[model samples]
Target chain A: MQRRLFLQGMLGVVAATRLPASTLLPLMLNGCQREPLLPGTLLSACDDARGNHFVASIQPDGSLGFQIPVPLRAHDSCASKQRDRALFFARRPGRQIYVVDLHERLLIQTIDAEPGRHFYGHGVISADGQWLFTTEQIYATGQGMIGVYRMSQPIRRETEFSSHGMDPHQLQWLSDGETLVIANGGILTHPDQNRENLNPDTMQPALTYVRVRDGALLESHQPPHHQMSLHHLDVSAQDQVVVGVQHQGALTDAVALVGSHRRGSDMQWWMADELTQLRMQQYTASVAVDANGGQAVVSCPRGNGIAVWDMQTGQLINMLDIADAAGVRRQPQQSGWVGTNGAGALVRIDSSGTATALQTLRQYPLRWDNHATLI
Target chain B: MKPRFVRKSRYEKKNRYVRKKMQLLLLIVALLSLAACNDDMTPGQRWLATTTEQIRQGYQQLSAQTRAQQQMADAFCQQPDAQGLQTMQAAWRESMASWQHMQWLRMGPIAQDNDDWKLQFWPDKKNILQRKMQDILEGSEPVSADSLVHASVVVQGFSAQELLLFDPQFATVEKFAGRQCDLLRASTTLTARVGQKLADAWQDETWLKRWVAPTATQAGLTPAHVRNGEILDALLAQIERIKNDKLGEPMGLKTRDKKPNGYFAESWRSENSLANLQNNLLAVQQLIRPAQGYGLFQYLKDSQQQALADEMVIKLDNAQQALQQIHPPLTSAVTDAAQQPALQNAHRALGELATFCKQKLAPALGLTLGFNSNDGD
Candidate 1:
C-alpha cells in the first residue's frame, strides 16, 4: 500500500511537470516494476544559446526525449549494444569523454584523456559490446592511436595501437567484427599551434583497415587526390564504406568530396556535376548510408544542402536544401534518413526524395552539432 | 416473478456531483498557474528587448546624419566656397561618427550584402583604396548610382569621401572640376541610400520579435542569452579594435620597426582619428549604461552579477578619462615623442577594458569567442 502511494505521488509530479504521455508512461511502468528503459532512435550533441553543451535524446518522430548537459563541447556519440549506455567523445584537441547510462538518463562517469593525447571525435563499439575503440592523436609525435577500452563497470583503457597514419578521424567495424576501418585524415595539427594544418602541402590521406586484436594493418587504400582529407565515414550492413572528405587544397579546385571503398580494393571517387560541386563549397561534414546499402547521403554544411548518391553507380541521385544542415543518420526501421542543422531544424527525408520538417522537435532553439548517431 | 429494484439516495448523487466540481476547479487553477508562469519574462528576454530598441535608435540616428551629409556635400559642390567646404566637412564628420556607433554590431543584415565592408574598409596595408580610386578617376567610368553600385566598395563609402575632401591633392576646387565632383556627389548619395536601407531593415517588427524569441526553424537560432552574448562580444570587439589595431599599430606597438607610423592611423589625412575613437567610447557607454533608460549594466546587476557590472562601468570610465587626455590629430600625437606618455596611458586603459571583457565578463555571461564564427576545420 505504501509503494502504491509512492507511485501515485510520482505520477502526480510527472503530471504537474506536463511531460509527454510517452515519457510518463515509461516512468509509471518503472515505478510499479523496476525495468530498464528502452533506447531511443536518435542521439546528438547540441549547444544551447548560452553555449552550454548537452547530449539530447530524440524520438523516432524527431521530438526531444530528454537532455543531459555536459561540461564541455561534445563532438560525437556512439551507443553501446552490450549495455544500456552511450559514450560521448569531445572534439579534437579535447581531453574529456562522458559515459552516459541511457536507461537511467544520467551521466555515469567522465574519463580524462591521457597526458599528451586527445580524441578525434569518433568511436565504435565491438559487436559483442565488450570493447570500445576510440580514435586518438599522440600530440607530441602527430601519430594516430586507437585506444581500446574494456566496457566493465568502471570503463578501463585496456590498450592502444598505432592507426598507421596521421590524424585518424572516424572508424567503424567490418562484417567480421574483428577488422576496423579507419579514415586517417592526413592533416596534422598540434594543440599548442592552435588549429593550423601543418602539413597541407604534404598531406596523403588514406583508408586503412586494421586488425583490432593485434593492431596489424590489414589493408590500405588511397584516393586519387592527395589533398582530400578523408574525415567522416559510415558503413553499411553489407560492409560498404562511404567516406566524406574535406578538401585542403585551393578553393578554386573542384574535387570529389565523397568516395566508396572496400577492403583490398581501390576507392572510387564520386563527383556531382560541376554546378552541384560548386554548390557544395568543397566541404562534406557528415555521411550516412541507408540500411539497404544502395543510397548514401553526405551533408554539406557550408553549402547548406545534402547530396544523395547511388552507391552502385556512383551517380548523384538527389540534393535536398537545408540551411546549415550537418548531422545525419539512417533510420533504424525505415529506408529514410533524418538530418539536423545548426539552425535547429530537424527534417526527415523519405525514400521518394520528399523532406518533411519535424515541427515539434524544432520548437527548441538549440543548435545541433556536426554529427548525430542512431542508438 | 416480479423483481424489486433499489434507488440511490439523493445525498449520494449530490456528493458525486460535488467531487466532480472540485476536480474541475483544481484543473482550472493548475492551468491558470501555468499560464502565469509562461507569461513572466526572463531577465535575458527583457535585456534582448531593450537591446533591440537601442539598435533601432542607433540606425535611425545614422540615417538622419547621412542624409544631412548628402545635402551638405551638394551645397559645397554648388558654391565651392571655403565656408561651404568647412560646413560639408563638419557634416561628414558627424555622419562618420554616427556610422561608428553602429559599426561594432557587425552581424545580421549589416554583415550580409557586403554592407559592412562597404561602410568602412580598414587595415588597408596595401592602400588598395587609393589604387582603386585612382583607377576609377583615370578611366571613363561614369559616376552614377548604377555605375557606383558596381564600383569597388572601397571607392563608394566614407573613407573614399574623406580622401577626396581632405587629402591635399584633391581638396581644392580645381580637383572637384568635372568627374571628381560627380564621383563625390554619387558616393555621398550612395552612402545615404545605404544608411536609409539599414534603418528600414532594423525597423522590421517581425524580425525583432523573432530575434527576441527565436525558434528552431529560424535560420540562426538566436536565443535571448545568445543575443546578449553577441552584444557583449561586439562591445568588447569595438574596444579591442580601438586599442589594438586603431591605436596600437600607429603607436608602434604592433610594428617591427618600433617607431610610430602616422600613416597607419584611421582617418589620418583628415586628422579625425582621435575624434572617431572618442565617439566609439561614447557609443560603448551608451550600450553599457544609457541615460534615461536601463542597459546591459542594469541587466547584469539584476542577474546577481553586481561585481562584474561595477567593474565594467569603472573600467569604461577610466578608459574614457584616459582618452580625454590624448589630443586630436592622433597621427601627429603618436609621432610626437613628447605626447608618448598620454598615448600610452590611453592604450593601457583601453587594453584593460578589453581584457576585462574577454577574461571576466565573457565567462560570467557564459559566452565563448570565435566558436561559431570561425571555421571549425
Candidate 2:
C-alpha cells in the first residue's frame, strides 16, 4: 500500500508534466497496482527548467509514464534484457550510475566509479544483456578505459580495456556483440577543470574498433581535421556506424561534423550545403540510426535543427528545425525518429522532412538531455 | 432481466452525470489557473518581448538604410560625378551601420536562409570580391537584378560594393563608366530586397508571441533562461569576432612573428574599418541598454544587479571612447606603434565587458555559460 501511494504521487508529477498524452496519462499510468510497470518506448535523463534532474520514462502511446527525481544529472542510459533493469549513467566527470528496477519502478542500486575512474556518460549492453561496456577515463591521466561489468554483478566493475585514445564516449556493439566501437573524443580533461579541453591542439579524436574479449584495438580512423572531436555514435544492424562530431576549433570551419564508417573502409564524410553547414555551427549533439539501417538522424542542437541522412548514399535528405534539438531516437513503430529539446518539446521527425509535434511539457519545462535510449 | 441489474443501471447513469459535472468544474479551475499564470509577465519575459520589438525595429532600420543605399547607387550610376560618389558612399555607410547592429541576430529568418551573408560577406581573406568583380567586369554578360539573383554571394553583397566604391583601383569616376555602375545597381538592389524581406518577417507582433510562448513546431519561445544563454553566446561571439578577426589578426596579435598586415584589415581600402567597428559597438550598446525598453540593463536592474549593469555601461563606454580616439583608419592603426596602446586599451575594455557579461551578469540572471551548446557530448 505504501508503494502504491508512492507510485500515485509519482503519477501526479508525471501528469502535472502534461506530456503529449496529458489528458489520458494521469488515469492510464496511475501506478496503483502491485504488478511491475511495463517498459516504455523511450527512456531518458531529463532536466526541468527549474534545474531538477529526473530519470523519465515516455510511454509507447506518447505519454509520461513516470519520472523519478535523481540527485545527479545523467547523460545516456541503457537497458538490460536479462532483467527488468535500466541504468542511467551520469554525465562526464560524474561517478555514479542510477539503476532503475523496472519491476519495482524504483532505483534499485547505484554504481560508483572505481576509485579514480569516471564514466564518460555512455555505455552499451550486450546482446544477451549480460555484459556491460562503459566509456571511462582515468581522472588523473586522462587515458580512455572501457569498464566492463556483468549484469549479474551489477555494482562491481569486473574488467577494463584500453579505448586506444582519450575521452572515450558513446560506444555501441556490432551485430556480432564481440566488437565495440568507441568514439574517442581525443581531448583530455581533469575533473577539477570541468570539461575544459586541456590538450586542444594535440588531441587526436578517432573512431576505434576494439575486440571486447581481449581489449585489442582492431582498427582506428581519424577525422579529416584533428580538432574535430568524435563524441557520440550509433551502430546499425549491418555494422554501419554513424558518428557525430563536436569541433573544438572555429564554428565556421568547413569540417563535416557527421561521418559513417564500415570496418575495413575509410570513413565517409557527409555534409549539407554551405548555408546548412553555417546554420549547423560545426557541432552535433547526438546521432541515431533507424532500425532498418538505411537512414540516420543527427541532432544539431547548436543549429537548432536536426538532419536526417540517407545512409545508403551518404547524403543529407532532410533538415528539420527544432529549438535546442537533441536526444533523437528511432521511432519504435515507424521509420521516423522522436527528438527532444531544452524547452520541453518532444518532436517526431520523419525521413520525408515531416516534423510532427508529439508532446510539449513547456510549463513543467523539462530539457531532455542529449541522448535518449529506446527501451 | 434481473432486478439488481435494473437498479445498478440507474445508479450508473447518476454517477456518470456527477462525474461529468466534476470534469467541467476541474477544467474551469485549470483554465483560471493558466490565466493567472499569464497575468503578470516576469521581468525576463518582459525583456524578451521588448527585445523582440527591438529586433523588429533594428531590422526596419536596416531595410530603410538599404533602400536609401540603392537609391544613392542609382543616382550615382545616372550622373557618375565625384559628388555623386561621395553621396553613395555615405548611404553605404549608413546601411552598413544598421546591418552591423542587426548582424548579431544569427537565428530566425536572417540566419534561416543565410540572408545575413547576402547582406554583408566578411573575412574575405582571399580577395574573392576583387577577383569576382574583375571577372564580371571583363565578361560580356549583362548585370541586372534578375541576372545577379543567382550570382556568387561574394559579389551580391556589401563587400563587393565596398570594393567597387572604395578601392582606389575601382572607386574612380572613370571606373563607374558603365559596367561598374550596372554592378553597383544590381548588388544594392539585391541587398535591399534581402533587408526588406527580413524586416517583413518580423513586422508583426506574432513574432513576439512566438518568441515567448512559441509552439513546438516553429522554433521560437525557448525558456527565457535558455534563450538568454544563446543570446549571451551570440554577444560574446560577436565580440570575439570583432576583437580577434577584425582587429587582432590584422594587428599581428594572432601571428607567430607579430607582423602587422594592413591588407588583411577589413575596409582597409576605404579606411572605414574603425568606423564599422564603432558602429558595431554602438549597436551592441543599444541592444544591452536601449533608450526605452526592458533589455539586459533593465533585466539586470530588476534582478537587483544595478551596480553590475552600471559597470557594463562604463566598460562599453570606455571601449567606445578608446576606439573613437583612434583617428586613423584601422589599417594604419594596426601597423603604427603609436596607435598600439589605444588599440590595446579598447581591446581590454571589450574583454572586460565580455567577461562581466559572461561571469557576473549571466550568473546574476541565472544563466550559465557553456551549457548544452558548449559542453554537450
Which of the numbered candidates is closest to the native, going by highest TM-score? 2
Worst 10 residues of 2 chain B by lDDT: B213-222
Interface RMSD of 2: 5.5
Clashing pairs in 1: none
Clash totals for all candidate models: 0, 0
lDDT of 2 by residue, B1-377 (tens): 57764556778888985786455434433333342366565666666655766777798899999999998898789879999999888888888888888877777777667787777766665676788789999999999988987876778988888988898899999989999999999999999999899988875444443444444321233355555655665776677677777888788776446798877777777788888788788878877888876778887888888898898889889878887877678887877888889888877777787677666766566653433553466
State candidate 1's DockQ.
0.07
Q: Indicate which candidate wins on lDDT.
A: 2
List the global CA lDDT of all models: 0.75, 0.76
Displacement of residue A190 (Cα, Å) in model 1 is 4.3
Cα error, candidate 1, residue B306 (Å):
4.4
| lDDT by residue for model 2 (A54-138), tens | 9987654445656889888899998887436789999998998989876557887899989998998998888877788899999
